[model samples]
Target: MIGRLNHVAIAVGDIAKASAVYRDTLGAEVSAPVAQTEHGVTTVFITLPNTKIELLEPLGADSPIAKFLERNADGGIHHVCYEVDDILAARDKLIADGARVLGGGEPKIGAHGKPVLFLHPKDFCGTLVELEQA
Candidate 1:
């Protein structure tokens, strides 16, 4: 089952600049940048009063974020991640209830260092959904 709403990811061209802007301009406290080499990106997390904001920048040319940014210059909301109690169960339930998964059928480690899986946008009312277990 789903728990709470986790961080909402925003794909950016530059993580440091975005983190600086959020910290200095908006007075948001940013967390230390972390590298997710498996996913091919570096991220800086800015914790908010409610939910967290993740500033994601591509680490290399073959990174997915690179294609995302290339597809849209303005950059858009990448995905919405939700905290789940059981990722496999949640995934099964969602699929049983008619949801399409984007990546692996099993959960994989995400940017937050938790098991995560993405439901396809087509199955999520045109918005990509990420289910993660804390």
Candidate 2:
């Protein structure tokens, strides 16, 4: 089952600009950009009082964010991540309930260095959902 809201990810054409807006304009504490080659994204985390905002930029031509940007030129909310006590169990239960898991249906190391899995957008009311181990 899902736990607390982990983070809301926004796909951005320019991560530096977006991070600056959060850091300078909003006075948020933004972390340095980190390249996640496995996930094919370069991410910057804007820490908040309660949660965090993730800025995602495509790392390569084959990155999923590139495809998302192609569909949405301006970029937008890419996904919402929720914490889970047990990813495998949650995944199994969701699958039994007819929810589709993305990728190879296995947990991968996320930006936080935690195990994470992405559910198909179609299965979650047109919004991509990421489940991260808590």
Candidate 3:
């Protein structure tokens, strides 16, 4: 089952500008940009009181973020991540419940270096959901 809200991921056309808004304007604590080639995204994490905000920019022409940007000229919220005590168990339960997992239905290393899995947006009320091991 899901635990605490891990982070909210936002797809951004300009990660620097987006990071500046959170860092300069809102005075948030933003981390340096990190390129996640495996995930095909360059990310910046903005730490928050209750959770964190993840800014994602496409890393390549074939990046999924690029496709998302093509559909949405102005980038927006891409997904929401939740923590899970036992990801594999949660995954099995979700699967039995008819929820579809994204990718190859296997866990992958996330930005936090934690095991993570993405659920199909259609299965979660049109919002992509990420489950991270806690």
Best by TM-score: 3
Runs in model 2 deviating more than 4 A are none
Cα error of candidate 3 at position 48, Å: 0.5
Error of 1 at 90 (Å): 0.6
Worst 10 residues of 3 by lDDT: 60-69
Q: How many residue pairs clash in model 1?
A: 0
**How much is 46 displaced in model 1, in angstroms?**
0.4
lDDT of each: 0.84, 0.92, 0.91
Instruction: Report residue 130 deviation for candidate 3 (angstroms).
Output: 0.4
Expressed as tens digits, the lDDT of each residue in 4-123 for candidate 2 is 999999999999999888889989999999999887899998888899999999997688889889898888999999999999999999999999998888898887899999999887
Q: Which ten residues in a row have the lowest lDDT in candidate 1?
A: 72-81
Cα lDDT of candidate 1 equals 0.84
- State the lDDT of candidate 3 residue by residue for 1-134, as single tens digits: 68899999999999999999989999999999999888889999998999999999999767878878888888999999999999999999999999999887889888789999999999899999999998
- Pick by TM-score: 1 or 3, better one: 3
Q: For residue 23, give model 2's deviation from the true position in Å.
A: 1.5
Q: Who is ahead in lDDT, 1 or 3?
A: 3
